[model samples]
Structure formats: C-alpha cells, structure tokens
Target: MSEGGIPTIDIEDFPAQMGKLREACEKWGCFRLVNHKIPLTLMSWIEMGVECREIIKVYAKAVHGVGMEIAGKLAESLGIISSSGESEEIFRDWACQFRINKYNFTPETVGLSGVQMHTDSGFLTILQDDENNGGLEVMDNSTGEFLSVEPLPGSLVVNLGDMAAVWSNGRVSNVKHRVQCKKGEVRASIASFVLGPKERVEAPTQLVDSEHPRYMRL
Candidate 1:
C-alpha cells in the first residue's frame, strides 16, 4: 500500500504483481496505476476535444483491452483461475462504456461538491483524471473517512465497483467516492467502465463454499 491509502500498481510488473493488484481491489477498492497501456498522447487528444466521437471510439477500444487484462489478473489473483491463460475468458465479452466529463468551476462553486458520493454500478472503472486540479475523494475502508486523492501525473485511477463485489462474492471492496470543487478552475476526466458480464453474473464455485457463500446473483 502507498502512503495515501491507495496502492500503486505498475503494469510493467503484471503477473508478478497480481498479489498487489488483488490486495488493492479487496482493501482499497481503488488504486493508482502507472505504466498503463494508454498513451499520454491519446489522453491529450481526448482532452483537446471531448466532443470528438471518433477519437472517443479509438480511446474506448484501447481502454477496453486494458480493462480486460486487469480483469484477467484479478481472476488469477483470487485463485479463481490458474496461470494457464484461462483467466482471460472470465470477462472476455464484457461490455464497456466510455465517458468524458468536463467541469467548469466558477467562483460560487469553489469549496462546493462537484459530484456526490456514490459507488459505481459497473464492474470496474478506469479513470484518467485531470493532472492540474485536485478534487477526487475516496472513503477509507479502515477509518471510514473520505480522503482526498491528489493528482498523480502520468497515472490512471482504477476503481472497482458494485458488480466487482457481486462477482467476488464479497471478497472485493466496492468503495464510495466523489468529486469536489477545490478550486475555481476547469477539470476534465476520461472514464472507461467495464460492466458486468453479458449473461448472468454469479460467484465462481471456488469462491462460494461453506465459509464464503454467494452474496448475490446478478
């Protein structure tokens, strides 16, 4: 874990860092990722024109690949799938939703809440937050208090959502988070959500036993 309560995972350290990634999902429900697949140039292009649907399409495809890879790692870390490459099938066909948000803050909005605290309904979300402004906050699972998430340059934020908890059978954390207005400036972010499976979603047999039963079916 890092000093800020969120863990940092480097994509370059994959398979080897599966333990770290699993810990982040179960403990923090979120983490800061470095050395991800998305290029900084692509991020800049997306930010330059949020209304450009063509650019968004390309970005979504790239992000979807990363999301699936992360999902496979999660499965491997949980012991649900072995290293024989079967983990990739766990969420190979899951859907993705791309979103770009721009917040134009004014004098009246300073020190106010930008987005209310809530948990995402999808399986997971990959976020590229603004590098300049700081307003994101996540609830600390240990202390039950919201902590500010400072901007980390060249890093992406990953948040596990409600469906993650459902799929993990209560093993993973589905945390609450929100955006605030710390300064009267514009803020923009790109979010890619990997929703639950296309078919029904249920906890794997390995995770549902006597001690750890299935929590819900969706």
Candidate 2:
C-alpha cells in the first residue's frame, strides 16, 4: 500500500471514488484498487484455473469485461463517453489478451531486466501483480523519472493504456513501466489487456467537443 503518488480507489464507493479515479488516470495512468466486488475466493479460483490451464482465459475475459464497465462509468463521470451509454459495450468488443508471466530466479541471470520499458499499446490493462515480489516501476510524466511500484496485497492495479489516451482526447495518461528482478525470487503476475476496436480506434464525439478537441486520431 506504499503507493507514493498513485491513489487507492475503493470500488464500493464508486461514485465517491470516480473523481479520484479520474485524477489518477489523468495524472498517474495507474492506481491501486481496493474494495473491489470480486472476492478473495474468486481470486483463488482464478489462480487454480491458471494452475489447471483450463479456464484462465475465460476468467480473464470475464474480469476484463467487468473492468471495462467500471472504466466506462468512470468515463461517464468525466463526460468522456459517447452520447449514449454504449461505451462499455463498445469496449467489450475490443480484443483481449490474457497472459501470465513467470519470473524465476536464476544464478546466471543476475541483474537482468524481467521486462523492458514500454507503454501498453492497448486501451487498458488489469494486472494482478505478485503480492510479495515487486519489481515494477513507472515513469513520471512530469519529472521524466521512474518511481517504484511496491506490492500491495489483495489489490488489483489498473493502468490506462495508449488507446485510453487517444480515446480521452489526451486527457488520460498512458503509463510507461518496466520490471526488474531485484531479488532471487520467483514472481508471477497475470494481466488482461483490452485492445482497441477491430476496425479503428478513435475518440468519441462527446469527448472531442469544443472544450476538448481531439488529440490523437488513432
């Protein structure tokens, strides 16, 4: 829970938290989420599904679909959605990438990067980071420096991706992050990405009104 700048959002107080969520997205492009409706038991089930390699993708897609609804509501609070309440449905159509990464410690691979620095080239990513192991870091958009993201137990980290930036007409922040294996420990994380439309990605007309002109076409 030692998130230096990123705020922690309580989903139970969704309406109350929308403002904070919007600020987090606009500034940090990522935040720690708590009070999520999902139960710890379900999370354990997802873990089991991963181990069984049977229902991992299905479960990830279901989680991402729910996450997208939350995102759309957040967008609504910011007046960034379409004229009708269709943004959530539209986002559900986006391609999903469900993946789990395993970082195992090796004596020969000391001081190697687990993941290189890069921005998520999608709309959003819901990550279940390792509760014990932490090597994730995100770049500060203003300072041009990287900040370490510590592990928060029983929390999901939501990151706004490239398509989010474009869809929000540049109001949203697209975070850049990388991973390092600081300790000789095995770390595992699962992520679900919501890629943009099958046709083309664009900001909704409501988001590009006079007050907020379109920023990125794609």
Candidate 3:
C-alpha cells in the first residue's frame, strides 16, 4: 500500500483480497486499483463520440444509487455522525452521491487552460477515466503538494472523502485532485461516491476496535 493505502490488484482476485481490503479500509480509508477488468475497449467505445451516451447515463445513475446505498451501510456499520447532530437525517446529503464531469481539451471550459483542481464532497469516490489518457492529479495531505496520478489501463481510482474522515474519527482523509486534458484528446471521467450517514454522530464504532474491527457493514 502507498501512503494513502491505495492497493492495486487484478479484478479476478478482488474477492480473495477482501480481508486485506477490509484492513486497508479500516486503516487508510482509500485505495488505488488496477486490473479491475473494466475493458479498455468498452471505455474507448464510450469516449468515441456520443454513441454510448445513453449507456453511460444509465450506468451513471446506477452508480449513484449504489453509492448512496453503500454510504448508508457504511454509516450504519461505522456509526457515522451527522453534521447537524441529528441521527434521523443520517441518510441525507452527508452520506453519498455521484458527480460526472467531462470537458474537451480547451482553455476556456476548464478555467485553468487545461486542468482544474478540486476535492469531492462525498465519503468515498470511485473514478473511471478515459483509457490510455493521462490527466488525474492528487494532493498529498502530508506533504502539502500535488502529485500527478498516471492513468492505468482497466483500473479504477478510489479516494476517501471528508465525511469519512470525520466519521472514522480522523483516521481517513479526503484527497484533493485535479484533471488535465491530454493534448488533442478530450478527457472523460466518471466519479461515484459512497458517503457516511447523515444525522449520526461522527465517530468510530466502539463495538469494533479502533485499530482492527471485526466487521465493516459497507
């Protein structure tokens, strides 16, 4: 695992690595992934004009739903807390959501000539970028510097969010990132988030040990 607990693995072995993954989640709250088998061809097909717009849209919606559910479960399992101090509102915005933003390689649209930096507003984010294209950059909280993240073919990038850190009692951290368009190639990325529950107190679960938990609901 890297500084942020990012783990890369073959898609086929994901199930076998669940134990390690759970440990990573408990400790670092984020992971980088490789060989997830998302298929470069499919990714390419989606980027080749508007032919796959409908498919992409549907997939995005599904991703959002899944993210929300996952957030709720994470909250329930981790004993998430709400910013407003109301446990009933745990399923509200502080939990989970998805954001999909795409931009052509142009100076005007992205506001920074070709790149834009920002942090997501969810507990965890799952990102899929254009195959063979490079643009993602993440900030290293420890060093207070930005690091260029190379795009890996058929891989997904995952990051923990602010709410997650709060819910986990500062154990996790939300990463800052930016996207730069490659010369002559448009950039496209899909981001799905899993957030903690709203209205719940932001704290780690006592039932589960602070260092190693026996069970993680999400």
Point to the candidate with the largest TM-score.
Answer: 1
TM agreement with the true structure for every prediction: 0.93, 0.86, 0.61
Assess candidate 3 and give its lDDT.
0.56
Best candidate, lDDT-wise?
A: 1
Q: Per-residue lDDT tens digits of candidate 2, residues 164-217?
A: 898788888999988878678777888878878888777778777787777876
Question: Per-residue lDDT tens digits of candidate 3, residues 168-194?
Answer: 665455566777655555677777776
Instruction: For model 1, give the 10-residue run with minimal summed lDDT.
Output: 1-10
Q: Which regions of candidate 2 deviate over 4 angstroms?
A: 1-5, 45-51, 54-58, 81-86, 107-111, 209-211
Task: Show where candidate 1 strays beyond 4 Å.
Answer: 1-5
- Local distance difference test, per candidate? 0.86, 0.76, 0.56
Prediction 1 TM-score vs. true:
0.93
Clashes of each: 0, 0, 10
Q: Which tens-of-lDDT digit does each residue in 105-198 have in candidate 1?
A: 8878998999999999999999989988888999989888888889887788999999999999999999899999988988988899999888
